[model samples]
Target: MKGLLKSLLVLALLITSMSVAAERVHLGFTVHYTLKSSAFSAKLDRVVVTKVNQNSPAMRAGLFPGDVIELLNGSVVAGASARKLDAEMGAIRAGDTVKMTVLRSGKKVAISMVAGET
Candidate 1:
């Protein structure tokens, strides 16, 4: 009986956590990067801008492929993983402004874009 009660409590908690994750908002863009190790580690060697959807916030903000992302909202992303970056972006809601620093052709550029639904 004690084991059954414990199992039920754990199941309930898992359901609650799943529901919360389902409510997260989309940041309307996809980011791809090169990781020297695993996703669990914060060791991204390069953040390559692979795609920018048409009419999306990133495209509207002039972000294009071949641009390397350097910072997010004033935080350095040099060693941040793809998952970590996705989580940080996922936490933002639509209409929220995201400030990003990027590198293009050896030049550093800063851009601010509003988040939108995918």
Candidate 2:
């Protein structure tokens, strides 16, 4: 039947496309988890720290570019980058705690800090 043929083609494509996803995962080292939302967007992935702007919020918070954001809130950050953390931070505001998790030195840790402008 035509319907059965179409389903087989879809399955074949799905199986072949999985490799591309895996390659993307291997390209970078980042762990990001985004809560459900359609209005907000962010690209979160493992970042290698090559520099930390002088006197920047990141420096003040003791986080650098290499620090991988492994989790947001309590969820595992394993897919679909959306680290636009700085962009969406306005809602959180200054002096409010931004609960975050990170993968540092192969260890998973939770940390919280007052939200501040970059």
Candidate 3:
């Protein structure tokens, strides 16, 4: 009986821990997004295009470094890193189609893209 109680307690704790360990998306500033139901959000930021790879897809797609990614795959690009963003950009490889929503010259621009080496 004691062992049974201990097992029940451990199972209860495990279930509680699993449920609470989930990460809920929160949008704070950087293009805030809120909704009635639980949602996930990513912040947006301005980035400078330092250089464009020679003969790469970005060049072909007419994307410059100064262009900022305001939205990625329909999610706000908050606290996103360049390396991590590749996946968000759709793991695009040469000849693969990708899309982007960006803010350039104070205007929202959307571009169809293919991934290329940086």
Candidate 4:
């Protein structure tokens, strides 16, 4: 009974998160996690930008493919779980300012853009 209740709660939260993701403001970009091997630590997940649509806020902000995402909305992206990342990203609404930090040419660059309609 307790297990069933917990499962239901998890399912409810998952559904809510998915709905938010489905309605999230468009960023005109796409990303995916890449495995990065470290010497001291275990493998790490790095969020890499795969594409940026033309004339989009992301493109205007200078985001480019091959850039590694370091931060989103001032939050660290290095160790965030995929679900948490999705929830945070999905929470953005149109006109909301989105801040990001990315690694390009081995240097960190900060960027800000307003979310747009999907």
Query: In order, what lDDT does every prediction score?
Result: 0.62, 0.41, 0.44, 0.68
Q: Model 3 residue 65 lDDT?
A: 58
Better of 1 and 3 by lDDT: 1
CA RMSD of each candidate after superposition: 10.4, 14.7, 16.1, 8.2
Off by over 4 Å in 1: 1-28, 38-42
Candidate 2 structure lDDT: 0.41
Query: What TM-score would you give candidate 2 relative to the actual structure?
Result: 0.43
Error of 4 at 72 (Å): 0.7
Which predicted model would earn the best lDDT?
Answer: 4
Candidate 1 TM-score over all chains jointly: 0.69
Best by TM-score: 4
lDDT of 3 by residue, 3-110 (tens): 534543443232112122233211110212211222453222443343455565546667665666566657565465333443343233344465668777888888
Per-residue lDDT of 5-109 in model 4, one digit per residue for the tens?
454345324322233434646677776564443564323278788778888888888999988989888888786655566667667777788899999999999
Q: Which of candidates 2 and 3 reaches a greater TM-score?
A: 3
What is the full ranking by lDDT, best candidate first? 4, 1, 3, 2
What's each prediction's TM-score?
A: 0.69, 0.43, 0.47, 0.72
lDDT of 1: 0.62
| Model 4: per-residue Cα lDDT at residue 28 | 76
lDDT per residue as tens, model 1, 18-84: 2224353333344555556554443666766766767767787888788888988887787765456
